[model samples]
Target: MTETHATNPPGAPVFPPGRYGRRREPGRRRPLVPVVLAVLLLAALGLGAVRLYTQYGDPAYDAQVITYTDITDSQVVIDFRVTVPAGGSAVCLLRARSSDSAEVGHEEVTVTARPGERQVTARHRLATSERPFIGEVLRCRAPA
Candidate 1:
């Protein structure tokens, strides 16, 4: 067996200044690549989310007013078009508005088509309570 000796000198501290009694500092700086990559990844995901919504998440039906005529004191005629999904039905709210923005007439029109037909066009004659300035299809939706 080798001879054993006391590890620390009697008049000196058990450890040196840099061991545990001094402030700790980083030896080498951490690389910035990981943080930058994380930020870029988050940005890419956010952009993808927005793109997905705009591309595939929008409401599909859009109603277009083709013509409106015969605006009498008690009636209005409107022609409009709407698109529908296969085997789907839509209820459109038709309205006639006066010059002062008062709603003079209102009705719900149901539109449907064969499974392969993607669109439907219709003419509506709304009976109004007073003279109206415009006839419009306010909104259309799929029925439950």
Candidate 2:
């Protein structure tokens, strides 16, 4: 009979050819947490840009004279109403223009209202014949 050496080096593991005794099952499929987070981040960035444009970039200057009483050569006192969407506010800019549509004077005012109807008063000067128009900027919340 041939001699069979029965010696396994320390800390060394040997396994049969067809089976690794421990039978390692397929690893569990990990959840796609990282992918989900990346998608959410991209979506948030898009939404934030939209909000910024609506709030600061696009201001629908809506000027209405509630009361145009005090009138003078240098200044005119006129009470006006400012309207904006609920859950936000509007900043009114009184733009004074020259007869040739040149901006000569501009005054900014802030008005906040709930998610409904809000009425605010503003007074501006009629520096020139370029009739005054109201500019309303809707300030809203950004994406989380």
Candidate 3:
């Protein structure tokens, strides 16, 4: 006759085991959809930024001084041509400068192009404070 003690038998296994339980389900993996969407979103934002910079960073209208005359002691007449998008009104800033490049006069003139015409010719007479040695267009733009 034999008695079994609290301790395991010498030949008995210390613990019963087969496969350990997983910390998480192996079939349930990290989703890849969110990562792909994040990348696509970033790419789209970058393209939009590039497009905006290219569109607004540069001047849109083209201008040239066709001719100028009637340069009096305190006045000047300027004739210029502007090429811009049709159907929109544009504002042209004119400046009269002395031989030393000092501003003697300034004027903001507005012009409206025909519905299908992008080029327009204009002649304007501006008042000045002194005799202007040079009169030209400072800048032109479509009102926002």
Candidate 4:
């Protein structure tokens, strides 16, 4: 006969074999909350990166002044060069206006210089009294 302690409740079995042991379901795991959170975080980061690229990391138009000369009779000549990132064409313009708000002139030219240094010459004639201390616009553009 086996010896037994007498603490069992009325009508209960004397010893329960697996009562105090922990049981695990091997194939049943927790839901993938952390994995879903990680994926959402990465997607947000990717969208932010794309927005930054479109907002601030884009290229702009490029140009420079090579030489400028003021001629007799209030005529000014300007030489400039421009470099385009992709396309290879440019246009030059000389704008002349009077200080007294009397006269205005816009001169346009075709520029065909290579990426480094192309020579463009533009001429403007202004009235002697209307020579602007605040001069005109010199614009360059990719050939359209």
**lDDT tens readout by residue for model 2, 35-54:** 89999999999999999998
Model 4, global lDDT? 0.54
Whole-model Cα lDDT of every candidate shown, in order: 0.84, 0.54, 0.83, 0.54
Model 4 reaches what TM-score against the true structure?
0.39
Best by lDDT: 1
Of the candidates numbered 2 and 4, which has the greater TM-score value? 4
- Model 1 off-target regions past 4 Å? 1-16, 19-59
Which pairs of residues clash in candidate 4, taking residues 3 or more apart in a chain or in different chains? none
lDDT-better candidate, 2 vs 3: 3
Off by over 4 Å in 3: 1-43, 50-59
> Which has the higher TM-score value, candidate number 1 or candidate number 2?
1
- Model 4 regions lying over 4 Å from their true place: 1-59, 100-103, 115-138
lDDT of 3: 0.83
How do the predictions measure up, each by TM-score?
A: 0.63, 0.35, 0.63, 0.39
> Tens digit of lDDT per residue, candidate 4, span 1-144?
433446545675454445656434336787699999999999999999999988876343355655545744465555555554443456655555555665445566665545554343333343343353333446666556
Clash counts for all predictions = 0, 8, 0, 0
Winner on TM-score between 1 and 4 is 1
* Residue-pair clash count for candidate 1: 0
